[model samples]
Target chain A: MIDNIEIIGLIAGILTTSAFVPQVYKTWKSKSAESLSLTMYLVFFVGIVLWLIYGISINSLAMIFANAVTGFLALLLIFFKLRFK
Target chain B: MIDNIEIIGLIAGILTTSAFVPQVYKTWKSKSAESLSLTMYLVFFVGIVLWLIYGISINSLAMIFANAVTGFLALLLIFFKLRFK
Candidate 1:
């Protein structure tokens, strides 16, 4: 069974992972990413991927799930950054 | 002593946290935030704060350091989003 601390981590993961949704939606609707930093998203995507690998190494389901989803979302943002450019 | 796994985690934390620096620099120099979603930064800031608390609870130095710095950076992004509007 998961403990309270793990639960907090899970919630934190969820919040951070899902936080990208609105930005994705907004960017999609606007079809403009001028103000968005491609470098930031690129670096962030690499970081998320590293986080995913680290999560896998540690066997933390929470980290795996969060980093996986966030990595995907960050990838999409990168794509949008390029496509919208 | 830190293990390989912890080192990976530390590198991941460093990448993710420092990823925002370019964004902050870009936004600061550009002085425009039209394409930035305020909601994203707001939610991200909250998530980072939660992550910091979770880090503290778990006594993970990496998490604490990453989240603390990221939280501050995210907050600055939020402020820029508002002020540059």
Candidate 2:
């Protein structure tokens, strides 16, 4: 049986990953990223990449899935940041 | 003895948790969050809280520690978002 904590983690992962979707959508439609800090997001992207590697190393389904989607979103934000700036 | 996977998790956790600090600092100094999507962060905050709870339930020290710090940073961002806007 799957553990309860993992379930909770999955739910939390979904919520957090979905959180980025709106940011991507807004940035895409609004075509603005003036308030975003480039350094902050660049660091964040690196962090996400590390999480992805760690997740893969540990064979964590939740971690891998969450980081993959979140990483994609972070990339999108980065794209918006560069394009809009 | 601490296993390698957990070590990776710890390193990944620290990197991600610290990612928010720069964002908080930038937002604080800039006194603006216009480019940030409010809905995204609102959902993200709730997600972080869930991660904290899940971490506690699982007795995962790394998750608990990481989420606690990230949650604080997220709160600060939310505060800045509200105050600056």
Candidate 3:
């Protein structure tokens, strides 16, 4: 039961991390970061980075995977923000 | 060093969770869920829920606090989405 729960957590993490793709794609395609605040995304990126480090420290693959993908998506958004705005 | 790092993680989690306030407030005040995607928020909500459960299982307060606040905010967003749209 516990293992099943963990597996669900891992799966959920993956899905959420992947869900950012559409936003990333839309932002990239439109060249618009107007709706996305730079400060917020920057801080979010940093937070996720720290979370990734924390995940590694605890040897938690789920956390690491989730944060890694999230960080990547956030970075893309940040890049678009800088590029367009 | 480790304790300090964890503290920082906890603080970051809090700030990020707190950062969602403006979005929630705006959504609530404007009564607009046009910019927000329901499916995304719904999926994100469930993901955060699982993350919270995982955090509790592993005895990680940082994750718990972060996801709890995030889930609450997401729930608010969902409520707005339903009410407005």
Candidate 4:
């Protein structure tokens, strides 16, 4: 069973991952990404992919889960940037 | 010494953490946060703070380094949001 720290990590993972939800929603609704930084998101997407690979290697549930979800969110943001452009 | 995977994790950490530099720079230059989502950044900041604590508990250099940097960037974003307002 996961201990307290891992549990803390898990909760942190959940918060960070879910943090993207509102962003995606707002961007989707607005269909305007003028203020969003494409370069930042592109670099960040690559970074999350690396983090995902790293997470898999380490087998940390929190890392894996958080990066996986964050990766998707980054992709969605990129998609919104492209579509809105 | 750190192994291959941890090194990969470290690189990922640097990339993701640095991803915000361009954003912070652009925001600082423009001094406009209209399209930026305050909710997302605020939530993300709290999450990263938890991540910092969790990383310290686990003694994971990658996590600690990443979250520490990302947390600073997130705060910068929030500060821009408020200041630009």
Candidate 5:
């Protein structure tokens, strides 16, 4: 049961991480983020950055990993939005 | 110092949860998810679901709240996608 739950957690992490891929690809391909929300991304980037710090403070590897990657992706979007806008 | 970090964490939580809102609004208003990837949403939905479960297991209010809202938003997008597609 424990192992099963761990597997589920792992799956969850993988899914969320990969889910951003399409948006990443779309932004990368079009060099446009007009459809994306700049305000939201900026706020979210800050939030994820905090989460990363929290994860680090708490020594939570999973949170650290997930938020770090998500933050990176969010940052990429921010970059494109600024560059293309 | 600790209080400040808590504030930061709270802001982070809020940002991530709210980040899904614009996408939700856009999807709702457009009645289209042509730019959104179904596969990514489905996977992210599952991941958030697991995160919710994990939150429950750990009794983490912040995780539970954030994931629940995000999952709900994701579900709404999924519903729109299915209905419009």
Candidate 6:
């Protein structure tokens, strides 16, 4: 059975993972990414990929799911940053 | 002794945590946040705090350190998003 700490971690993962959606949606809708930092997204994407690898190495389902989605979303933001520029 | 998986997690945490630095620097230097989504930062800050709590609960030094720094950085972004707008 999952403990309270695990539940907290799960919620935290969900929040952090889904947090990128708004930025993506806003950028897509506005068709502007001027103020968005390309460096930040690039670094963030690489970091997310590393996190995904770490997740897989440990076989943690939450980490795997969170990093996978977050990484994809970060990629979209990166694309938006470039395309909208 | 730290294992390989733990080392990987540490690297991942460092990457993800420090990823926000460029963003904060860019936003502060530009004095503009037009393309930055306030909603995203707001949600992200809350999520980082939750992650910090989760990290503490799990007794993971990496998580605690990463989330604490990331949370502060996220907060700075949020402040920049508001102040620059």
Q: Score residue B52 of candidate 2 by CA lDDT.
A: 85
- Model 4: lDDT of residue B67: 94
First chain of model 6: TM-score? 0.90
Please give each candidate's TM-score: 0.95, 0.89, 0.81, 0.96, 0.82, 0.92
* Candidate 6 lDDT by residue in tens digits, A1-85: 4678677767878889878898889999999988787888887888888878876775556667788999999989888888989
lDDT of 2: 0.80
Q: Candidate 2 falls in which docking quality class?
A: medium
Tens digits of per-residue lDDT, candidate 2, B1-85, equal: 3577667667767878877877777787888898778888889989989988976885656667878888888888878888899
Please report the candidate that would top DockQ against the real structure.
Answer: 1
Ranking by TM-score: 4, 1, 6, 2, 5, 3
How well is each residue in B25-77 modelled by candidate 1, as lDDT tens digits? 99999998898888888888888888888778866677788889999999999
Give one digit per residue, the lDDT tens place, for model 2 in A1-85: 3577778778888988999898889889989987777776777778777777866775556667888999888888988899998
Tens digits of per-residue lDDT for model 5 on B1-85? Answer: 3365456556677888898788778777877676676877898899899878866665556667788888988898888878888
Error of 3 at A64 (Å): 0.9
**Number of the candidate with higher lDDT, 1 or 4:** 4
Model 4: per-residue Cα lDDT over B1-85, one tens digit each: 5888878878898988998998899899998888888999999999999989987897778888999999999999999999998
- Ten-residue stretch with the least lDDT total in model 4 chain B: B1-10
A38-69 in candidate 5: lDDT tens per residue? 88788778888887786666555666778888
Worst 10 residues of 4 chain A by lDDT: A54-63
After superposition, candidate 3 runs with Cα above 4 Å error = A1-6, A29-31, B25-33
What are the candidates' C-alpha RMSDs? Answer: 1.1, 1.8, 3.2, 1.1, 3.4, 1.5
lDDT of 3 by residue, A1-85 (tens): 3376568668868767866676677677777655555676677778888888888887777887888888988888778879988
Show the lowest summed lDDT stretch of 10 residues, model 2 chain A: A54-63
Best by lDDT: 4
TM-score, predicted candidate 2 vs. hidden true structure = 0.89
Score candidate 6 by DockQ: 0.74
Candidate 6 Cα errors over 4 Å, as ranges: none
